[model samples]
Target: MTSLSPTTRTTLGRKRNRAASDRETLYAVLDEALICHLGVVHDGTPLVLPTGYGRDGDTLYLHGSTGAASLRTAAGELDVCVTVTLVDGIVYCRSLNNHSMNYRSAVIFGRARALTGRDEKMHGLRVLTDHLAPGSWEHSRGVNAKEFAAVSVLALDLSEASVKLRAEGPDDEPEDVAADAAWAGVLPIRTVFGEPEPSADLPSTWSVPEHVRTRVSEAAAQ
Candidate 1:
């Protein structure tokens, strides 16, 4: 397994045991999570917002509109941070303090570059599209000039990143465990895509496409 070289920003000071030290773990977290929160400092104010993201090898792409102030500010000289988290289960413990969650999370810190060139922008868009809506790029029409002009894409290199995972049950005090205070266990949380529901405007006769079927299957298998 390839290990990660932790930088000062990527280093985990608290909950050290929960930190993952492998690059593969980071990749796994990013691949399984669909949404990421983008954190940026704009106009001296810290702004963190939920956004859609896609990864291309070591580069992470964030999606936003050209008119968004956050994206515009992030494209400047300041650095940005992106985080992805997947909740696997809820941990119920004997005490309220011991109650926790089982989760896999990744934090990325880097300066993002705005893709401007036509080829680079298209490639970034394709990667973003393929990750969120699998096979959609090939199944649907390409982006036109007007549509392309309205969207903004940011690419942040994955040189500085950290992955943390918590998979076990709750950790209760010895006294609490001995007393058998209450029911203590984990409620496994599984996220499986349900049957695809078509829009009301669409005819009921329309069948689910092959790409959507594959996506649903892949999501369940994960």
Candidate 2:
């Protein structure tokens, strides 16, 4: 468990300015995001692939087919960078170049190791499933030994990470603001959950789980 280091660079760019140094902020953003872009060096070339992930405490778990090439390479001793971004809105400004997005993102850099133990694998799978559908883990079928063995899990420590965020309207210079008359403001964006639709094959006796119901309610309230 390594602690997050301070980011030295600072710029007006949202990628550099909206950064959150606190560990809690980074973890929260990571937890909320459904997908993460994993960046690793393969054969001396950089590779960035988006994949699903789960977080437990200070570690991030990524899973894939056991035969995956990227997973095989990453499972070995190698440093990897994982990034997650959540776009909150579009920032329109008077100047085209000044226009940007409001977003929260987290970048984690660490060495990844394959999880092999049965207990660890189960735990990792539970975390991954729950991360996607909060309460689905308990409601859904558990993984069998064969199924678990067919899947590969990689664990990355969350230490050595950074969080960057940008919120609010565009940053236009006074001169540009006066010269341009375009609408300049933020168009708020969000990930909304639509009305729950029962699965086509779901048994008639089955009812919507509390987790699903609660999440729908929360999304509606938002």
Q: lDDT winner among the candidates?
A: 1
Which stretches in model 2 have alpha-carbon errors above 4 Å? 1-3, 6-16, 66-75
Residue by residue across 1-222, what tens digits does model 1's lDDT show? 777766777765748788888888998899888889888886788888887888888898878653233546533533788899999999999999989999999999988777788898888999889888887998888899999997778888888888888999889999999998599999999878888888899988889889998778876887
Q: TM-scores for all candidates? A: 0.90, 0.86
Model 2 C-alpha RMSD to native:
3.2
Q: Which regions of candidate 1 deviate over 4 angstroms?
A: 66-78, 219-222
The clash numbers for all candidates, in the given order, read 0, 2
Clashing pairs in 2: 18-165, 19-164
Tell me how candidate 1 scores on lDDT. 0.83
Worst 10 residues of 2 by lDDT: 7-16
lDDT of 1 at 135: 79
lDDT of candidate 2 over 1-222, digit per residue (tens): 333674442223445456677788888898888888887786788888877789999888886542223545533645677889999999999888988889888877777777878888788888888888898887878777688777877788876788788877789989988887788999999897887899999998988889998988888888
RMSD (Cα, Å) of model 1? 2.2
Task: lDDT for model 2, please.
Answer: 0.78
Kindly give the stretch of ten consecutive residues in candidate 1 with the minimal lDDT sum.
66-75
